[model samples]
Target chain A: MSDTSKKEFKRSFSGYVEICENMPTGMITVRGDLNSRKLKSAFSKVVGATLPKERKVTLAENSIAWMSPDELLIICGYDNVSDLMKKLQKELDDQHHMLVNVSDARAVFEVSGAAMVEIIAKLAPVNVKTLEIGEIRRTHFSQVAAAFWLTSEQRMKLICFSSVADYMFDLLKTSAVVNSKVGEF
Target chain B: MLIFTCPYCGIEADETELTPGGEAHLKRFGPGSSDEEFEGYLFNRENPKGVHFERWRHVYGCGKWFHAARCTLTLEVFGTYSAQTFEPPEEIKERIRAKRPGWKWRNFS
Candidate 1:
């Protein structure tokens, strides 16, 4: 509960588009056998969020995004993360799984506008033109590991390591320069 | 500019998103082995011009290690497979032979 132990920083860059840092969010890394019926049902009970398909996200009271073949990230309210983690542990105690609270290890951001696709294209190698709703793209921005998904229409939510938040913010700001839109997407 | 599809994640990742992990399916020869055998294991490597299988890590994405089979000269990717094998799969080898018939990769022919 002390401010000195916190690395709280917020910044915004409004150019041809709006780019802003998001508040801290709850993220839990759940790695296990995703094909298990018990894991699926327990996830629904713990957060009421379904287990998402590969490279997709399930949006409920809490959102669950598939990070890899056997890894899913459960996103909930930061204050409720511990409670949810305990619930998940109790639900799947007998099953083989690894659960870790990664809320403070990442920084989330939002880039919204018509040219949001082009802004991401400037840094990543992924083609977002055909990205369906709730589809996640786990790619790197220039040199750092990052992932993003379309949380809603015309709004993309991105997450990167906390240590690279400043660098990612600068990349987002530079890519969102006025009139620099490539218009390909 | 080579794009490799990660077998685990099922995504075609650009070379920038991947980190090459040298050749794949290398058998280790440690102590008690003959000098020639250990030397061959550590120093010798296949440099086939037609089909070569190598290891790659999808570091920026799923962070899984997978094997890729491709040509050393033309840079054409025959296919990509999992890294959980001591040898390329039979189907992958057959596919490579179909592309470059009589292509011999070390003793794999």
Candidate 2:
């Protein structure tokens, strides 16, 4: 194949549900005892947002989400990650924690439109309709482990391991097409 | 597909997101324990058709281990609770009793 053909082909669909891959961003996984005041404050200061409550995502100057009781995922500009990690390490030096740069390990997709919730409902077991505006959920999307968060009333972000990016894209595309056809019928 | 409420995240998770960890509250028979105790702990399991307690992990969700009270025959979930305890909480037993009346499992009334 030509180099042009080898280049990553971004897929998107616009219909009752819109699905598209999001631009790359810095992604970091932080694991520690979030109950500790010092750890919480340092994390909030470094990420520019407090660690969100259980099953929620906090969006402020930066986006920090609660992945688990002891884990948080931070998203920010790709350029800011290195310095951010360094600063966080310094701040948390005395504490027991783990910081991992997972920017290249995952793919992110954004889905929107009027039938967005229904489309996601087809793939995941979550009741996306009841998912609060800022809530996030970690679940499987058609057999692939995935997580999603509502970024706006009409938009949500889905993320999964990069190894299955193509599979995730295909599943979302198929679901969108099937849903749009159902609307027509 | 079973739905379980994760105690740590306080969110309902589908069976796909949760990994079943087998029967909960198994007493470990470690060093100095009798061979019979070790064998029972390692191999024997209470496979009840009615009310049963099992371990589940919200691996894809909050990554916490929890306990679920379920009926194996009917596939009806009684309730889910934290995995920290050695036995199902009193409240969960009470709920199961209210639903299954005259149920008997282990020592839980």
Candidate 3:
């Protein structure tokens, strides 16, 4: 066989796997006029309030509703995906609002071990200790912008762009192992 | 570390990506001020312990400035507002009234 016919592409990564036991986390983007009280009211009805203390259904356990003037990015448990979308759509019926379903377009990683904070700090810029309980933030993940929902005392949900999901997953897993010191909190 | 919740991005950014400028949206006095007044306006910093207000730049995110408050001891961030269209939230006003007793927000500009 000629060299041209037997050419091979160099592998950047060692081995590739089709499906990861890793299930994707749910994500949704909501946009509308934030100054309008009625619009906010409608959002409150759909996704509950910006504060969990004022609402019933929690997007994530102990998660806070972080909002801007025109946009709200909501993070909920992966299981309640379909129901939340339907509820949001119904709430904004005939209104000037949009809800884009991005659940499959992002990767979700639940970090909840004792040293989860330390592990995360290695990858992101924000100090885990500075983040209060029930805080939701849309920040960057190693140069890639992401939204984080601090779901519990120990649990944090990270949502990032799907195209880089595999890269992020690999980076996080490796960093966690190196940073997670044995017998240390 | 101070975190500024960006009004545009809705992300609470780190102190690393920000630069704190004492107060937010202050109107500068041109060549029409006294020496003492100018010194106070230009150099003095209100280093309050309980609730100090500071402006920050979201350099990496929106590249806009916003105001944020924090407790020196507890470091609890109560709220954040934008520099251009920042209207202090009512929740904060109520808290200040309750905590500071006789203190009032004196606005000159």
Candidate 4:
């Protein structure tokens, strides 16, 4: 087990986009056959949200993001993770499923500004500017695996493993520096 | 940069985000097999110049293992398929054959 409290750090940078880290989002990693009705019903009931379609993010009482064909990441209030995990385990006791409290294993960051897309584009090979509201993409952020979703046109949330939080933050900071703008082509 | 769409997640990933797993669809030779068969399975491989099947893991995206049919001569990728399959699907082979007529890669014609 990892000490979730160790090495906790938070920082922010000013640039074309404001890059802030350590926003503290609770994450639950669910693994199972996504097509199973039992899995879907149990998950939606506990998490209070609908299952997201392929490569999508759904926001309701809670937010659920499709991580892969057989995996999902649920984002919710940090304090409710234990309670929800207990309920989910009880609801899916007989099914071939895995529900884990991954809240402590990840780092959440927020980027705000009209030019937020430019900061993301600098590190990832993606066009964040055109990302649909409910769309989420899992891709490499320079050298690390990361996922990001749009909260709105000028705001976004990004998450990656806690182990690489510092690296990801620094990378984002460098990309957001005022002079590094990837202006309109 | 070479790109292969992950068959599982439908994400078109570049070579840098993927981990190549050498050859694909190899038969395992267990303890009862002859030394020649074991040696073939352990070390021998077909270094063909065209229409090769290889395994790759989408380490950066969906994290799924899949197979790709690529042309070594031009770095052209025919397509990617699920790694759960026992052999290359007929459609991919047909596409390869269409581009290179009468292509013979190992046991497949």
Q: Tell me, by TM-score, which candidate is best.
A: 1
Among the candidates, what TM-score does chain A have in each?
0.93, 0.89, 0.66, 0.90
Tell me the interface RMSD of every candidate, in Å. 0.7, 1.1, 5.6, 1.1
CA lDDT, candidate 3, residue B50: 66
lDDT of candidate 2 over A1-185, digit per residue (tens): 23433334256866568888865668989999989998878976877777788778888767888898889889887678888999999999999999999988988899988667776778888876578888888888988989998888778998899899989988888888743455421
Best by DockQ: 2
Please, what is the TM-score per model?
0.94, 0.91, 0.52, 0.93
DockQ of candidate 1 against the true complex: 0.76
**All predictions: root-mean-square deviation over Cα?**
2.5, 3.2, 9.9, 3.1
Cα deviation at A46, candidate 1, in Å, is 0.8
The digit string of per-residue lDDT tens for model 4 on B1-109 reads 6799888887778897799999999999989999999999999988988889899999888999999999998999999999998789999999988999989877887
| Strongest candidate by lDDT | 1
Interface RMSD of 1: 0.7
Residue B73 C-alpha lDDT in model 2: 90
What docking tier does model 2 reach? high
DockQ for the candidates, in order: 0.76, 0.83, 0.19, 0.59
User: On TM-score, who's better, 2 or 3?
Assistant: 2
lDDT of 1: 0.89
Q: Which stretches of candidate 1 lie over 4 Å from their true place?
A: A1-9
Clashing pairs in 1: none
Sort the predicted structures by DockQ, highest score first.
Answer: 2, 1, 4, 3
lDDT of 1 by residue, B1-108 (tens): 699888998888989999999988888999999999999999998877678989999999999999999898888998899888888889988888788898877668
| Whole-model Cα lDDT of every candidate shown, in order | 0.89, 0.84, 0.59, 0.86
In CAPRI terms, where does candidate 1 land? medium
